[model samples]
Target: MDNKKVIIAGAGHGGLVAAAHLSANGFDVTVIERFAQGTLGYDWTDMFEKDCFDFCGIELPKNANYVKVPESVFVSPNKKTKIKTEVLSPITNVNMDRSAIYDSLIGFALEKGVKFEYETKIISPIVENNRVTGIFVEKNGKKETRKADLIIDAAGAFSPVRSLLPSNLMIENEFDNTQVFETFRAFYERDMTVTPPDTDWNVYFFHLDKPGISWYECREEYCDVLIGRFNKFGEQDIKQVIDDFKNEHPELTDKIIRGGQFAFIPVRRAVGKMVADGYAAVGDSAAMTVALIGSGIANSMIAGKMLADVVIENNGKTDVKTLWKYNVRYFKEINADICSLDKLREMLCTLGTDNLNFLLNKGVVKGEDITAAIKEGGIKLGIKDLIEKATKGISDIPLLLKVMKTLNEGEKLSKIALSIPEEYDENKVKMWLSEYNC
Candidate 1:
């Protein structure tokens, strides 16, 4: 048996990815999962499949749920624009069955000699000398202590390891209520055999003329369609909204036989720097969901890969100070541009449907324009200029200016937020945290 052991909490994609890498690196790895199997099965895009497959040297599953969506179409009440080309995004611009991807990772880890403890829940981190040595786990009505050279907290949003660490570990966090999203989605089998429109792998993003409410539609295999309504809306209202949308878009309704409904609540915060004291948190445990977009699959996989590298480089030895490099790489390399996108989302939230209509009427902001602007530089300064210029010769110019100023303040705050990297020195991190306003 390998003396160097790594214990991973959670059997999700992130945890499984980490386990696979560690096991391949000659570490005796054990994965603990709360759910037995088939728990987290969502028909969404699985960005890590290709990379994970390559890493594990295996073939991927081809199922209806695992169908790929090639491009995204941005739609408003009456407008629609499609992105023609496909980019190699970490989280692919594609969609798949999220659960199948999870299951695949688990199988890969198991084949790589990683042990699994299904129906197991991790209570807390077992710490000695302030270094995470292992975990206190409960399984099948039995409690036991398992020790490992390193512990990876791949647990979801609410991490068990966070409470054990200092609160200042994530002082630069700036997530607002608006960032959180409540969504209802359902998979429906189409009534007709005729192929659905935009059937060649297209995702529709409806910017609901309202603030905080947006929806997406994508075609799946076997005449199925994935309809998702995301934002701050009640379940009943969401169902009604979907119904109304179906009615409004007869072309969509024609192909659909019936629709089912479900809801998903997502976190909208920048990935927190919580890798400390011989412990590391990845996936939603680190609040790594994309702010405006709400994509986390790829981010979680990336974190898993990164954490594995950091652990390998350190040769199983880790501490608060030494683990800081992992956090640095997370924000700097993988998550830097995503944080900027979050700031843009905040700015857009302020510009609700009315502002969009106004921009459309004035011929100032178009979908193409916005896309080109973001691709050219970023949505920050370019949007501010457009908003300022559009409000010219109107009494609301002052109001626009005020809003722009506030929006600029938000941008500045975001800049400060992005600048707060995972610092190694406790004193330096504390000083920066104290200086940060949000």
Candidate 2:
């Protein structure tokens, strides 16, 4: 059989991984990226599981610069109580510069014969007879269509290609504000004259009594600060948060080192439908991030490998039936836990500042609990643990009930996530999707 031609819409981490694998497996792969080659990723660093490279069959970059993230201190809204949580595991995660990650991934894909078309903007998917046959693209004052046997959408959360798909395909075309995290991230020069805080990493829940989270990480030369909200926030909102950070941390300087940009991330469970007749969505395009924190580098790469495996197994077929196996495998193996975390995230958002403060101050939520929820992607409390929390929070019966309800709902969501149909029957899949979304 002739090699299948694959077109990846974006240079996302997962897309690059899939491109490499598919190319190596005798598929003609091309990646179209809006940004230039050297400027593929964000300016700052991100933390993800260290095993992602190995899982994607790519070698770690020799010159990679990274460090183990320090323990994080979760501060209450009122700042009266703080819970310090240790790193999930000594060797489980690493903080690496985003540019370096892209360099490694792009290099690996290049070595595998994957072609790249930089400075190309993907306009939309070209659908013919309910099958995506190509993409309309604009490049250097030219507009044309690039045909391919398969189109892998590795575009970020707000992908025009995915959002503009034909409505009859049943793929979710948009993510509402509640399902997206609007984030502002920046790095400022550290003031050498001022003494740094005792904790190098601080995560403030409900910062300034707002319905979002803010974090400040103190490094040697700079401090990384981020403010994220479930809904859209404007420049004034970002300024207000930064001003608060400046007042609290004297070590933060006025000089901006790098990164003062706003980005959107998917902070919900993977979309109910991620495939169509001739297309597949991976990475942010598929909402693969951890709902609580918007961390997707690891998950995206792993899912990319899974996607490549399914495609290769099916003899390069890109039909919905052939690609549905990837969706089933991903939901069963990875997204089930993420679905549960999405529920927990909803619970956190519902808990107002006062309730969160009470939980923290009263020791109803502990550092270990936070660590476990993050590491495992959801809360995993035993009977003894639950009873202890219930007793401690007995004074606030309503809060206790809310917590219990969230846990119960999260469990049910996980079961539903895992119950995705093993075979792709249109009716069965549609019915399963209705329950999964509910």
Candidate 3:
């Protein structure tokens, strides 16, 4: 195969990982970050403990403060009951230094000969004869054009590639406006005097009565909190939320250390399709952030690996039909599961905090069991996964009926999603590509 020049835009978590994977495979990779060195790293290093180490196949320094949390507890404000479980392996929670991990990955990629340009902004995709040739970048008051065989869009939530295509352009369905939430997270020194009880190192998920406000904390010196706003909220709101949380949860208030402010992320699923003729997207750029709960690290890392494989397998092949296979496989293997989870989350959200609390406190509902069953294929998705997850614990006739109703709604949504496989005609696909519309 001819040597390939792969261009990765954005130096965020996913972008950096893609660069590392591609570089390891002998691709000539270039990573361009719009931000300075200190700002290029991600902010949530503490939430990911050992899981990241094994998942991404990276090692950490012995003195690293981040440790794995093997247990998880879910609490609902309105509900009297609480749910708890032991987290499985490969799903171990990790605590990390965002700057350290980012620097390590970037350095590893560099050691593998991956080239990088910091503070270089991608102005737009360079198109020639309707084919993507490279990109226009601006750096240090100089405008330069770099050519490449492929471009990976790993830019986070506010993706640069998003505007290059038509607004109506979609991968499977149009972008859904599910709302974005402002969130802040902090990492501190683990102070045994101020730590919460049962700190067997478990991740704590607090479900509030509010529509969007929710937070999670791992006892390992790092706390990640998110506040949902119906409309856009900023830094002030983040500070207020943190202050309120600290006051409300006094047990964790005293351990505060070197922390930072919150950032906004759309807690929505991705648009319909993920690829066009000459470009593709991964991570939050594709709106792959989970709904309800905002967890994208694992999903993005896995997507990076899958995308690398896709790009390597189809390098130099510019046809959309060949490249589009990435979409189908990704959708089937991962996105489809997320869609199901989104639907399930929508059901839970609509039920209100009262219902959630009642269900949690009054009955047996294991979130991990649901995810595990789905991953193990014990739960066939769409309506079936809901029925499986709901019925797995509920035995009362009233709750069983309610669970069945939920499953029915999920079934309806599944039918709608499944329609795409049949509705995807050549004209629609070609039209979406040629016209640059979703």
TM-score against native, each model: 0.77, 0.95, 0.76
Instruction: State candidate 3's TM-score.
Output: 0.76
Report the C-alpha lDDT of model 3 over 180-298, residue by residue, as the tens digit: 55555555444346655444332223333445655545455445454554345566665555565555444554344655555656565455566665667777777666654556666
In model 2, the runs with Cα more than 4 Å from the true position are 381-393
Candidate 3's C-alpha runs over 4 A off are 24-26, 47-64, 87-93, 127-130, 141-145, 167-179, 188-195, 198-208, 216-231, 234-248, 254-256, 364-425, 428-438
| Worst window of 10 by summed lDDT in candidate 3 | 372-381
RMSD of each: 4.7, 1.8, 5.3
Ranking by lDDT: 2, 3, 1
Per-residue error (Å), model 3, residue 340: 1.9
Clash number for every model? 5, 0, 18
Q: Say which candidate scores most in lDDT.
A: 2
Runs of candidate 1 exceeding 4 Å displacement: 43-71, 77-93, 126-130, 142-146, 163-176, 193-211, 218-234, 251-269, 348-353, 356-365, 368-377, 380-388, 391-423, 433-437
For each candidate in the order shown, give its overall lDDT on alpha carbons. Answer: 0.58, 0.87, 0.59
lDDT tens readout by residue for model 2, 22-76: 9999999999999887987889988888899999888877777786577789999
Looking at candidate 3, what is the lDDT of residue 61?
52
What TM-score does candidate 2 reach?
A: 0.95
- Ranked candidates (TM-score, high to low): 2, 1, 3
Instruction: Report the lDDT tens digits of candidate 1 across residue range 296-367.
Output: 776677778877777778776667666778777776665545544555565566666655444444444445
